[model samples]
Target: MSFSQFGDKFTQHSGISRLMEDMGEGLRTSGTIMLGGGNPAQIPAMNDYFNQLLMQMHQDGQLSEALCNYDGPRGKALLLDALAKMLREELGWPLTAQNIALTNGSQSAFFYLFNLFAGRRADGSKKRVLFPLAPEYLGYADAGLEEDLFVSAKPNIELLPEGQFKYHVDFDHLPLNDDVGLICVSRPTNPTGNVITDDELLQLDALAQQHGVPLLIDNAYGVPFPGIIFSEARPLWNPNTILCMSLSKLGLPGARCGIIVADESTITAIGNMNGIISLAPGSIGPAIANEMIVRGDLLRLSQEVIKPFYQAKVSETIAILRRYLPEDRCLIHKPEGAIFLWLWFRDLPISTETLYQRLKARGVLMVPGHFFFPGLEHEWPHTHQCMRMNYVPDAEKIERAVQILAEELEAAFKN
Candidate 1:
């Protein structure tokens, strides 16, 4: 059976599922060492917290009300208020319930922001959005496409010694137009795992203000890992800035809790849009998230267990890369606070897609850089040189996967 046509806007779109399909097929047949996804190792806290929430509701004889009640589109008051306090304490950002809008996940927060701001010009022309090259998260491009906004990505500018693999945003070289609506960047960026400096954020804020546009920061990986240090938020430099955060990376994706904090006008606009689309985030989701923060389980777990565990894993993975791969042949980024590594095969002769396929054949897998680009073919002609690898897997898996990846790279280079 043929499926009906979607809207014209969707014609040029490709979802993450398509990218995953190729990787999944390889893994299914070859039992490959998979590292393409950015999912955290485990979120047992969320599972336990959710169970406790259910038990409490059942015992209180409020299970039906808790599960079926429609909450305010803005979110449950308790969660928003608790999050406000957490934000102020954790990131030192002054906020309140009126400034936060809860969504299903940070991904939904991106969607809401795009829809809210990516409207046509006064002449009915589409606006363009700028994104960093080789971005850690892939959903931002998808959201931009869904809203019919053009996406322009600058090269991943390096900011490290010898400029080998460090990535930064060069605002001066960015192609800014009057039709540009927003600039989306991630703090402690995904895939690359590099953090933006305060000066860089300040410059970006200045640029956004000069253009009279908003800057959206995806802070999915800003929490301090064991040994690494990174900036956690944009210094209160721009009132027009919108910070999108998720509990997913911090051990609560299942809580389906994410937040968007902006100035009052932007928050109200997004809250209204969310009401029209999602009605409200389910009541229980916010309540459990609120409870986790209020009762101190979330903070305690993040500080005590999650931070050290992931930090060690990341450190170990970097050591393995240093041991197995040649320093000049393979380019690597030392991440400050995220779970993935961006590897560029500068000396390899093969394309990234071909290398990815070869690695899958040899019992390994990773995301080719092309999938992160919005219009893949037009925008990522040189993507064959790059791939994003996750280090959040178990120690045994990481060791095995890194060995396989190194072996595949050696073979690819020899060929």
Candidate 2:
């Protein structure tokens, strides 16, 4: 059997698929230490809140309506209106329901946004999505319908004290050329947890505006809600900025809700896509979140419960890594936010791919770093020696996993 170019491009084995498969196997297989995947930690407090909200919605008959009816492609009007009101009143961003569009998930939203801005153009020209930093989200590597749809620049590696490092946007050599149509980045970036400074973001925004492109900020784990960011970061949006948020990290992945805050034109484009694709975005997440927004519980829980939970987990995981991993050989990216800790095994004898296999054999699972460097045009040895570990697992399990990781690293170094 054969498939079209689109089918072949999407159906081919990819990094995101491997990550999901590993995550699924870890969930189903007993004793598999799940330090892979982007699944947010199951915070009991958040779970309890959701359970209570579910009961309340059920009693009020809101749950049935959400499940049975179809919202417009623009998404639940109430949720959009509430979100717009909150952002306008609280954050002082001029917005309305027209500025917001919801998709089934952030991943789907990215697919639409990427292809919308980039790829084959109407004039037979090709445009690419510019990732200001190289080691971006793995899911983005294959989002484009056209081949070679992304270009990236290497980051300035700032080596911090105590076996830590940070990635800074190399503004000196950013690839903001004519061929680029959109600029995108994930704040509290996945896999690395590196939060680009507010000034850095502003500079990017200015650059994007100058280049006549939209700056897309992936806030799946960022401010206002699901506030998993640990460092100081001011939420930013404007007419030229596209801020994408998700309910997945806020203990609602199954609900598959994604939010895009953009200008009216972009939202209309996304709505049209939604109408053609899924007919409409799913309603359950928006339904629950809308209630939370009205009661002011969404930001409260994110700030009070969600952020603290992940902060503690990150701290504990770092401490465990320090204890188990060889301090002189392993360097961890300074975990500012997000649920992951990026580990760079300095000059390991084997690639992280081999190390991943070795660790998986010992009942540990993690994503190799190579998968994260999409659109990187040059070869950098650092990419092969790194991996991303989800720190949301239990402390004991994480400790055991770190010990196994240390052992594997030691063996690899010796070999």
Candidate 3:
């Protein structure tokens, strides 16, 4: 008649819940501009390629049967093989189908992963997910089955020239305690679009290795696919690392396919979990994406099409923001990759939540900075004065939103 703690926590109204609901609604009031969602940009060329993939499948009469069948929890064998080959040949990672597993999406994969490494351990010891960066991903904040499942290090703010800044891992403050079950991070970070560099990753990997915990790389927006990353950071892989990838950024969010690359033992356990929980990963994404993997079109398209599509937008948005926002009062993080720009409003009169509301009433939507800093019960005041602006919208609309943001933030600062 009541509910378990998991049920209660999952049902609790939170910022992430609001974000998910907004993403699903997929529409704004007729005049309102919504810029909070993380949906991939709709590139016409990529759309054509996707349409072509389905059209060919339909012509070959492969669509109906694929839809009617269960692919098992491990996902399509052919896709796994394609991914395995790509990882081995391109990235030089020693891998095979045995090292790969599939899930509904990166979200479901993390739900499995966080609980897999963390959660209640034997002897009543509670393991935790260690995030070297505090403002990692809001979605992961509530992912673990245990309420106190995460430990995070507050980052050192590295302000750059031209009103830009970055969040560097404060390794000095990173807690490498024995209870840390895993090290997790998202390259091309979701809210801030900060790509954790190779040097930074190596240090974190070394820390994880020393602690005997696996390094979990959430590559939902990183290497070997979609390749939306604009940083010089290389796509990384190692036997001790867990690489989680998704097809969502490849313009196939509806297909709900996520691939996990790890050691065979972990892959086997994940496969079992997938079977018991989901019965099988959806067949649609693997069936279509496998061809792109085999033919090398996915990589080519990402390099030539996808990367530039978002990169241009990032450049455009930076120009717009730099023009409107006061140079000293506003700070924008370098849009290293991903479709969002992170802006910090220094010493504003009101919190970002209140700023979000004001902008919402003015027909603009943005994610407040407060929602991004999870697991850190205490934080710098700057944490509450930032906003993540999804730049995937039209240039005109995004510029409009930026103008509104600058005006509102400037007015707030004066007051």
Candidate 4:
């Protein structure tokens, strides 16, 4: 059994693949406490809205039209127009329908964008994607088709009061050189949930502009839509900036729709790739989202419902960690906006990868931190000392999971 370079590279045991596999396996196994992966919490209000929307769509014939018709490579027209109008009117972004394009999902959008900008080039010189911050999304680790497609700068860890820490982009030492092709960072970042400050974002934007490269923001958990951010963050996009959003966080992961707002040229490029690939992004998510925007319900739901749910979850989860885990030995990343809480065990005897296996044996699941630091060059012990835990599970499950986690940490330190 032989495979091509693409097949071999993708088939390799990758971090994203392992995270997804564990999530699926945990789903199948009973009594599993699922605190791993990036799955959004299923909020009842959101679910009810979706159910009603589906029913209405069915009644209005929108459901059948979306199912049976094939949209252009860019995506369904109504959704694009709705998004463009919403963002333009609300945020005053210089956007039109031409600026937007849809992909099968953000994962595929990233695969297309990363490979488009980074990797081998025409003139024999290769380019790499620069993650100004190291502890980025694990899914991005394998998105590139070529090996060594990324380079990252170590973050400045700010130890805050009350046993919490935050990761700040080390802007002074960020390696934005000629060889770097694109700049990217996730807001309310995936594993850590640290939202880079507005100042930091402006700095990155300035750097990207200076370097003549486009800035790609993975806003899956950021402003105006999912509205998961706990701290202050202004939505930013320009001709040079590519903002990627998703309906997945808005309680439609199965819909498989990803929205990209960029310059017309970039949108066209994405649309061309879409034609070559999935032929067009799925219409279900777009169909639902279009109505949400036009009816002026998206922002209201995000702000009044989804935001508060995650905020309460963060506060409760932090309190549980404080009560169960050793105060002196554990430090949490300041929960900003995302569903995940990052925990760093001080001087643990074993790496988080080993701890993950022990927790799995007890029917608890979490993502080890090492996977998050994809393009980091040096060996940093801090990476292994950390783990990402999601608060999407029920209250009883969360409490039980924390208890088991505390016990395992105590045992590991003793060993």
Candidate 5:
């Protein structure tokens, strides 16, 4: 039976699910030391907090009622207020409950924002969404496709061969048109783990304002990085700037709580769209998050407990890579904050795909670069020389994986 035509945008796109499924199948069959996926290995404070919450809810007779009730789409008011204050104090983005909308996670916020601003034109022309060529996250493209939005990647931000992995946005080369709906940038970028500078953010803000387009900043990995702080809430340079954040990378994915902060007008529009899409997130989710924020324990824990732990692990992983991989053979980005390293192979004989299969055969798994740019084979340079490896796995697993990767690289070069 033929499936009905999905919207044309979706027809041309391969969603994250397909990439994940393929990776999962490889992992199941090959049993390689898995390093490809960005799943965090750190335990979140919320795990213990949730247990305490369960006891309290049970005693208060609120557990069953919460499970049965349909929460309002705007989210729990208390949580929204707390999130706004947290943004003000933590990231310095001036916002309020009116500027915030709670969602299942940052991914939900991403989809909601895309649906709100990325609808089809009456003339059937596709709207455009811009992102960095070497974007750290894959969600931007995935969300854009579902809305039938065209994705345009800028050239890899030029950086010295031996300098930090950070790239600068060359605003001149970007596709700027009335049809461009949004520009998505991740602070403390995903794979490279470098934070976009404030100057860069200001420039992005200006461009978005100039073009009457929205700038979406994904701050999923902002907190743990040094020299990066959101200390005040200034209005986004453009009225169109939309900020999406998550507690997932902050050690709370199961809480399934995230916040979207935009101007009042944008927030109202998002709330309306959210109502149509997801009625409301679980009430308990927000309530628990609210308590975490209000008590200030969450921030303290992130600063004192979680950040240091992950930072040490990241440092150790980088050192291992430096020790094991020859400098001339593999280029490793020194990540400032976040759990990943973007490894670019130099003079490697095998394609990244072949390397991935070989590493998997040896019980080590890593994400090949192709999965990150599924549909743009024509635009990108053809070099299967890159992969994203997460260092947040178990210490023993990380050591084993790196050893296996080093061995594979040597073998590939020999062949």
Candidate 6:
């Protein structure tokens, strides 16, 4: 039998699939230094805290609920209550348990949202999701069910005095047209680690409001809960916005838990979708994370422990890059937050994809930049000249990977 369009689209060998496969297999390869994945490193304090909690639950015979029983499509009632309380107390948002929904992970959450707004609308015209940042998350490239369902505006590149760069939304190029079904972006962006400022977010919200479209914020690596953010960009929520968050970065990716908060109607739609698609969301992640949220422990731990851990890693990695890479030829995006650093090689003799293959042969792994540019229409040279490296690996691994990358760059330049 021939496969349907949906099957074909979903089964396609896309960048995201290759990335995930490589990441999963790379960890088992003893010699390879993995600098490509978005996986969060295990932190001792946080791991201990959660392990103790789980042990306590096991001791009290309360582990069965999370392990055996399936929760509602909206997820565990207690977890929902805890999230509601957290949002209400901290952000002063008029949110309740009814306003929240849970999913398998932020990836599944985005799939629902992307399909919810885009694809076939009431009219014959297919509406599209608009991303304000071009080189956005690689996961988003295949999230949509429909082909050509995403459009994006190129960012205004701001080069600093140092060999650093910033990516800002190019408002002049952003379209406020009827074809757009929604606007979406990742806070503390995935590939570049550029956090979209409050003013920029507010403006995007305003534009969405004006166009009667919802602005979706993928907050998987943002402030408050996981609190990976380093910049001044604070977490936000409004009736005009939809915030999707995850427990992955909090060292719970295995639990496969994600949360979504939005307008009541949208929340209901998402819940319905979750019910139909996933039967019910996973219970364990929210079960553990909710307690952390309610007790205010998650925020404290992230701010005090996780933030500093990654920050130090970023600092050391940046220093190593500075020492190795030729300053006149290479530039790195100043990492505001997140696990990865974006490195740009100016006028490289080969494509970043080719460089990725070379690095793979040399026992180093990194994501090529071109995979992150699916939404951008124009051919931007910068997109082909960059790579994203995660600095969360052990110091020795990172050092070795950086040195290999430096040598690769020199060789590529000479060739």
List where candidate 1 sits over 4 angstroms from the true fold. Answer: 1-15, 22-30, 43-65, 89-92, 132-136, 145-148, 156-164, 223-238, 375-382
The number of the candidate with the highest lDDT is 2
Instruction: Summarize candidate 6's per-residue lDDT along 117-213 as a digit string, tens digits.
Output: 9989777888899998878999999988889988988889888767998889999888657899989999988988889889999899899999998
lDDT agreement of model 4 with the native: 0.91
Error of 4 at 348 (Å): 0.8
The number of clashing residue pairs in each candidate reads: 4, 0, 0, 0, 13, 0
lDDT of 5 by residue, 1-415 (tens): 3454455545454546655665687567754566777666555553576578678867877666666777677778887888777767766676778988878878888877775667676787556666644444776666653443645554454444553344556566666667777777777677666666676788878878888878988777665211122222122323478877676765557767777778888878877876887878667666666666766766776666666767777778877887778678777765666678878785777788898878767767787765665224255443367788888777778888888888888888887
For model 4 the local lDDT of residue 302 reads: 96
The reply for model 5, stretches above 4 Å from the true place, is: 7-15, 22-32, 44-50, 53-65, 89-92, 123-125, 145-148, 155-164, 224-238, 374-378
> What lDDT would each prediction earn against the true structure?
0.70, 0.92, 0.86, 0.91, 0.68, 0.87
TM-scores of the candidates are 0.86, 0.99, 0.97, 0.99, 0.86, 0.98
* Ranking of all candidate structures by their lDDT, best first: 2, 4, 6, 3, 1, 5
Clash pairs, candidate 3, are: none
How well does candidate 1 score on lDDT at residue 69?
78
Quote the positional error of residue 43 for candidate 4 in Å: 0.4
Model 2 gets an lDDT of 0.92
Write candidate 4's Cα lDDT for 1-415 as tens digits.
8999989998999888888899999999999999997889899999998899889999999999999988999999999998999998889998899999999889899999999999889998889999998789998999998999999989999999999988999988988889999999999799899999999999999989999999999999888989999998987898999999998998888999899999999999999999999888888888889989877999999999999999998899888888898658899999998889999997899999999999999999998999999888899998999999998788889999999999998898787
Clashes of 2: 0
* Pairs in clash, predicted candidate 4: none
Model 6 residue 4 lDDT score: 95
Q: Which residue pairs of candidate 2 clash?
A: none
The residue-by-residue lDDT of candidate 3 on 160-211, one tens digit each, is 9899999999988887788889899999898898998899999998888878
Q: Candidate 2 or 4, higher lDDT? A: 2
Q: So what's the TM-score on candidate 4?
A: 0.99
Question: Stretches of candidate 6 above 4 Å error?
Answer: none
